[model samples]
Target: MKDIRKYDLAIIGGGAAGLTTATHVKRCKDLSVIVISKDAHISYSECGIPFKLAGKVHDFDSLIVKTPDFFDKMGIDIELETEALSIDILNRKIELENCDILFDKLVIATGGKQRIPQPLQKYIGMDGIFTIQTLADGMKIESALLSAKTMVIIGAGAIGVETAAGIAKRGIDTTLINRGPAILSRLIDPDMAEIVSEFLKSIGVNLITGNIPDSIEGKERVENVLISGERIPADIVIISTGILPDVELAENAGISTGELGGIIVNEHLQAFVDGNFSTDIFAGGDCCEITDFITNKGTLVQLAPAARHMATIMANNICGKDTVLKPLLGPSIYVAGDLLIGSVGLTSKRARSEDIDVITGYATGVTKASYFPGSSDIHIKLIFSDDRLTGAQIIGKSGVKERIDSLAFMIKKKATIEEMLSIETCYAPPVSTVVDPLMYAIKDAFRKIKART
Candidate 1:
């Protein structure tokens, strides 16, 4: 029989969630903890890849928040390049290639995998074709950029748009292709997306909306991409369609998954098996399903901040603290050129899909007093349903993130337009207008609601 290593806690990933859980567990309890990761590198900022490529960040090494040495100092054991083959829930043992791990408690923080559409699957291993999900992936793309003159990025989600903006700013002829008519179709409404789309063009990204790549043509490496019978030259190709939860190991162990293909977990971050929650097994990060604050339905939030938050909650529960995760608003912010784009909760399209009757309010103003020096244009959109705030979108050179965060809180609290109108705000000629853009948006919503009444 092979020797099995036993631990107080075993985390199945080394990404943001897994490392965070390990650290938090050590902070609360003096337990034997180990993190298993298939990748060679760990604890790096996956979200900073585009910024690094764009030269906004100095180097990829700086993206690494913690090294194994740092974890060692914290008394956490890490097993790099170790993959979990399967899980035996009844035995609490994880089968690996050369060994097994027994644990008193197990955390499934498998994170997510980049989504490659079926049509593009054949080109995945081809030279000059890439996806940016890991530190290695980002490094590979960076190396390719050294010789590439033109680049084509497929999908216009946040990653795609950010990558296009970054690459274009580097003097590379970059093209962004989106199947939807508007970029960031899921994040913001079309009108707000137009503001970003126009800015992308102004910064030299060749925008191609409402089209899909027919094929990637190359002899041994990428030469060009075909879309609607037009061939666009490309020295390299990046697929940024999206990410999907990595729940294979969990599914193989008989864990239940939600419709979104993520492991189903309770409010306490406990994993489920055949509809019953497991006390010894917990899951978090991009691999687990969480509730949408507005809709109260299962949703996948793949952002790093959400993953860290979930890890903290899971750690508390593991330490015998009765803490529960609050439903998430799925707030997100992105940079494009000089603008900060942000959105929280649902868009009008998503609301209608959920059978929600939504009314919207729009306001355009300056980040500061109109006459204030260095003031920049700001656009706001507020979405309300049944007199309560449900969502918001903002695009501006400044104040976008703070405003979006405030709206996320309002949506989570189910604040009504009336409540929003009565809230107090601060004003500085250098920082904000006397009447914040958010107030004007709320007032607009109130007027619309009154008209209906």
Candidate 2:
């Protein structure tokens, strides 16, 4: 039996990875589990931060999945208000802000930190400025929003779009600014991003694209926003730019970090550098690198699902199950008001950057039959190489993510366009057409390939 004094396991961070790690081990009903969470709330969804700020969650309490009391009932010790400041791998000791704990196994799911970017850093904590990375950040913004009027959001990722929608829905003057030519350019093509931008502008969102912010014109608190010599009046400026991995503690401990500033972990999610190894010391979540299943290269993908998947492997390995860690295909979905956006695999630009020859086919269609009452426009663009599905970009109001996920799976498995031609899907008059649009897009991509040949 593992000594009780030296706990069976230690899980840092209370996000999806850390929480699931403890819960999965708890099912074994043998080992003593201790979870050290720096945050006050446990199992709160970090992705739901923007929703919380928008009052979609109603209250801060509504965001938590479970409290310390809930953990008590499950026989898991949750150490809240406790910060794991540093890790002493050789000594197997975790130095907390106030105390020290020795552990038999350690899992560092410490998660990422909110960065406001180099150009946007000065305006941080300027009353109107905020980031939607953590629950604490969400709560802080929600409290500050009581006085904010005109809000300008920087960046055009999921967080930016979501926050823009929230502010627009709240009757505030909302403008979403992007440094690139289009929104979510990193994820999809400019044309696909145009679909989203159009929808945002149609729904009362001030869309600002292809411009860099000259300065955040604020005295002490945010008062005015400037971008490309244009001064827009603003009471708040939420810089939903992006996130940087929280590698400070890990770096200080001399753990290997990735090229994208995330900690470098192996297939087992073990952090290594300079022949140094920490037994049972694993890192996952946004704080770690994403091993692209296709290229076998470490990419920066901060998705909760990937983190949870990593946690599962880390848990089983800790339990002596010896599970293999699977790389991810980088599937993602977004909801901007009525529009549900989704995509998977590589974008066309990314594929070309890798020096892969590609053919693209696009189709603009409806989600349902023409007779349907509540149908929205469904646009699909597929990337094909050698008649195989290489990548895709999709934008629609409904059933967008489902098709993207399916297409992404096919791409990872190297499914041919002919394979997509044979796929049978559920169809209805009100919700779907007789022929799925994916089939049509694949058929179109095939025709283009034939013509080129």
Candidate 3:
């Protein structure tokens, strides 16, 4: 009955969301927060793993934003290089590989492990097969790429696109293998993805869309991938298909789970333990689900930004501060070569899935004033559900991220086409046009919506 471990709050992961929640609670006298991370660093970015592989980051240290000393200064206890094995909620104890600890309020923030495709786990332990989720994964990929001259990446999402671009830029024979009909099949529309696909192709990378590898051809080491019954040579294989939530601890502790094995959480970010939030446990990040802003559907988007937003909500809720998390409007961006590809709100695919008759407008415009130097072509696509700006995408340079952020705010506020058309933005020749490209996108959408009505 002797006690050795105790904390007011125990965060189980040290990734983006975990760090945010810990930092938020650091100043509170009522909460003694400790973050248990398997990683050596406390607040490093996971999405930057691919960029590191491209020689963009000099080493693993450059990718780390903060050190162990930084967390100490913040008064947050950090247990680095410690792995949690399981959770015992009835006993209020977490069984780590090394020791056991007790927590008053538990935060399951283990973001996600890179998921190797199903039926491939037996082969995943094989050398040269990789999934980029952790800092370690990036190092492993970097080491492997030194010996590999050609690589094939599976998946067409943001990671796959970025990895392909990076590898091609490395002068490696890179090929992107996508099962979807288009790149970013679920995030961006076919037209916008086409822009991305074309960019990757232009950079001397082999691009394959609407196709898949039937099998890994190598019996010992990954030698080739069998697609269309033809064996394509490959020196390395990166499984970037997607990531699933890490729900092992939740399920074993008898916590309720949502669709796709995500930990079920209420508006207050509390777990649905004992049929209520009183279980004194909460979860977010890749481990939980959130309401998609446009469809009001439960979505399993495990992006870093989404996790950070959810972290703030979890912190407020855990501190007994009455707060609610707003639904996600799906604002996200991807970098492919020189293009800052991005989107917000809904996509054409999502609109049709809901049986909503939608009209869309597309314009290939400049990222800034046309007369400005370095002003490049930015193609925008806007989807509409009858005068309402449902979703939009931008494939451009210079202003892609900001425009996407602006569009995301509009979508979150439920601004109709009229409001979007007149959104007042600082216009300069270098950074923007007097007419923002998003406005052009929205005006185009308004016209299409009018025609549809």
Candidate 4:
């Protein structure tokens, strides 16, 4: 007989969303909570993996924010290395490899898995080829880095580019390949990506864009990758193409998924099943599709911060609080060498793709007073639709993250150019300019709007 366990709330995932929901629920109510995770470690920062490899972070152990023991001490039952095979929606039971768990309410937060390009699918699990999705994967790459002399990273997304930069900084020859015409094509416009491309090159990373590898050649290990009929030698190959939501379990249980392949949930985070929203079943994180703040269309946001916010909303709803998840702006920031790149909402390219007519404004200034010792050049771009702030992109040695965050809020509130122009800003010689770069960017937009009208 299979061992059967029961709890008031059973969360199927221990990543950012699942664990956060578990802790929040426990704090709000005295309900018995259990978290099941397929991965051995949970509560670790996936974003820190590249930095750890680059020697910016001390070690992998430091990336872990909490352990299973900590959850146990908090009275939250956690099952590590336990894969949930399927869910019986009618019975409210989750079937696992070793046991069957019953729950009064359930939260699905399966997160995402690294997407392997079709050309390299067959070479998965082969020696010298890797994907960093978990602490275990990062540790393996760390070990392999000791012997790796040359590395080829496929996909020029944040992870791929950051890893390439980090590995190259370690003195390893690195090549970054992207199928798109520019790196971070989804995050920023080609113009902004050019800046990042140059920075990566300055740090010794070979950039290859607008091409796909024809084949990965090697018997026991990856020795070379053929791209554009050109063969490049490689001691290691890392795939950072993209991430797909893990929704097989939810689909198998007859839960509805959106066009983006993520579970369809309501604003309250309740999952839709058989064309009806289930009060007892909820979904969040990368596994669920959320609405875009500007378009109000379903989209998948795989960032950890978005996942945690969804988790909080889900927990609040479960605790009988009337909390709802607002639409997502999908703000993101990345570190490549000494540059901090950030973007929020839609880029000009994305807005055009969505058929949105937009006007853009650009400004270049210094992060601090020109005479300040460590002042660096900062570039800002603002995208506006009908004079309302829609998106922003910023690149510099510093001051990018906070500005992106502020712009995200403005976009969420539908701030207008006039409103942005009148906003107050703090100034300091060491930390900021007398007139912030964002102010200049706003002024630039205002000028464009005035000229057009």
Candidate 5:
């Protein structure tokens, strides 16, 4: 066989994690790097797609963080619209549809694909039906809105809620259908989700829970969604069910996958191949699973921050350095109209399901001083297992993200309820109250712990 095109590092996928790894490796060393992206456009923010669809972002192109030329300037090759066929581990080569390439090190960051239920698969490929996973997906939705007066979004996760808020803001009739008992069921508890549901209702958006899309009915495009026996009129339909890891390449290469269907990796982010850890192959991003900080369970966080952290650690080890990725707490925040929600670690519901003896405290206060201008109601819930802080959830228009970050740090440190009660918080009229809302939450949790003792 002839000599194949070679590189020091060949990265599959050009999403957040893959881009991070490529940039870090090139910046740290003189290694030749190339990134393969299945999408024609790479380096765009997937998280910002909903904002673009909602008109918060003026232009879709603005979401493109780094262009292909930018990466070329940084001494990295970006191959767009390329698909990886399979990996030949023994030969250290990857077979692409166009050509075969050899690499000293291989990084798999294939990201994720929007998971549509088998029942809903028949509705796809229609002009008015879409899934918001890429910039192209957003553009399609925007174009469809010209004739779409009503939309039915299935699945009330972050994407669904955000989309509903955005479409409703545009004076379009929007309805959010959630199969679970509450919106954001995976992120926040029902109590917190209740506030969100009410906010949605107050904004003139129809919020329906405990209902599933039975089917889509339309001629050439989506027209209505049938739930049970009710026929809900809709000009457009968005399926935001969830995402699943793109692990076909890894599995076809004879790589091991974890229980969660993501590529298995060690603490160093090295891929487990052939019954052992392989330094030459690494994986990260939504395509791999990590240990949950609180539950010690194999979980897929699928957050950009977590993926970036994993990429950094994987790159360091790939460059002849030693670095281990810590367990992920999956810190995340999302906006739904005026409400900002933040969550980290485990939820009280999840903790109890794990059979952990959890004590929770709930507190409500103003994000700013009571007398300050623009103060908003803030609700916090802190969970303690065996007197140690295990989880936190925050809901507010302002100061929610920052407070959740502090609580996440406490959980990472295994801080006790006593430590959390005394956490130092800055007080101000505009930014925070004299007593922070988190402090009140901790105090309540400590009181509950003491009472139990």
Candidate 6:
């Protein structure tokens, strides 16, 4: 019989959430902390995979933030390539493959898993077909690309679009198959998505919209994708159909999960037990369903920043410091080719669907002075309910990511249109105009709101 190991805190999964929690908790108090990671490597940036594949980032090793040795120095025990087989929540024990671990407090940071369509599951691990969500997946895809000439990417989410751009940059003929009528439908409205679609096409990406991939047909490896009776030849296929929370382990332990398949946690990031919060167990990262600040409804915020923030709150609460996870505005940004796209809170399309009356203001301008040699076109769309800013989306080659972040903060603070318009933004001849685009955008929104009333 194996000996049962014990710890003050035991964390499952070692991505952003797990690592951040361990770091913060250890710093606050003396605690026996052990982090269980199923991955071959820990503390690597998952979002940097696309840029690394496209050669924008020179080395893959640079993506790793904390090595195993670093964690050791931080006084945290890490078990690499070790999986937690089961959880005995009532007994405060976890069953590993060969041993049992007991903990005073448990943190579930299992994150999410890539969702491959049922028809496409059989093609996984086969030649020419791949789903990327880890460093190893990126390495395998890069190795396979040496022999691939044409590629077909399913799903037009951020990863798929960014991957298409990377492949297109190498002059490979790439086709992006989007299940929805417009790409990034969840993040931006159709009009904003159209701008991105045009940008993708200009970079030589074949765009297919409103089509569902029916089957993957090949003798041994992926060779053709059949959609609506049309067979499209492909040398390689990458599926980025999004991810679902990795909640099986949590749910198996009697933890309550939401309708969206993510663990349901209270404002303190503790699991809901018998319709109440349990302080003994906590969950964060992509696994826990978070409250949308605007709607106050349970939603999954899967971005890295959201995970980090949740981790921080969980760490604080675990260390005898009362901290609560705040509602999220769901701000996100994506870079595709030379374009940077950003959005926060509700989209105009989403507001209308939710039956919320809203008006939008749109403005197009250059990132810098009109006479600046490298000045590029920028577009901003602001959605307002009455005189309060509800959401915003920005597309530009430069100066968009920070603006989206600013707008997200505004939404979080419930900033009115007047407040947004009066806030002074730094400007220079080469960097920005004396009058920021946001100022004009808010003014336009104000005018529209007046007309609507």
Per-residue lDDT, model 4, residue 307, is 92
Candidate achieving the largest lDDT: 1
**Poorest stretch of ten by lDDT in candidate 4:** 111-120
Per residue, candidate 2 scores C-alpha lDDT tens digits across 1-453 of: 322235778888888888888888787547788899877678877767777666677787777777778778878888887888888877777887667778888888888777667877777767677777667777777777787777888888888998888778878888888888889877788888888899999889999888878988767777788776789988777777777888888788778886889888877777775565455788888888868866678887788888778888888878778686777887888878777778776787888788778888888888899988988889898888787877777888888877887887888788987777889989888989888787777788888888888
Task: Give lDDT: candidate 2, residue 387.
Answer: 79
lDDT string for model 4 (332-415, tens) is 999987888899988988898899999888999998898889999999999999999999999999999999999999998899
Per-residue accuracy of model 5 over 1-453 as CA lDDT, tens digit each: 544789989999999999999999988889999899889798898889888877888898899999888999999989888998889999989898768889999999999999998999977898688898988788888898888899999999998999899889889999999988888988989998998889899888898899898789999877789998788999989999999999999999999998889999989999999999998999999999988988888899899998999999988998888999888899899998788989987786787688988888999999777787898999999888988888888988888888888788888899987767666778778888888777778888888788878
lDDT of each: 0.93, 0.80, 0.81, 0.92, 0.89, 0.91
What's the C-alpha lDDT at position 301 in model 2?
73
| Prediction 5 global C-alpha lDDT | 0.89
Model 1 alpha-carbon drift over 4 Å, by segment:
none
Q: Once model 2 is optimally superposed onto the true structure by TM-score, how far is the C-alpha of residue 55 displaced, in angstroms? A: 4.5
TM-score-best of 1 and 3: 1
Candidate 3 residues lying further than 4 Å off, grouped into runs, are: 1-3, 424-426
Q: List runs of model 6 lying over 4 Å from the truth.
A: none
Name the lDDT of candidate 2.
0.80
**How high is each candidate's TM-score?**
0.98, 0.94, 0.94, 0.98, 0.97, 0.98
Lowest lDDT sum, 10 consecutive residues, model 1, at 410-419
Task: Name the runs in model 2 displaced over 4 angstroms.
Answer: 1-5, 273-278
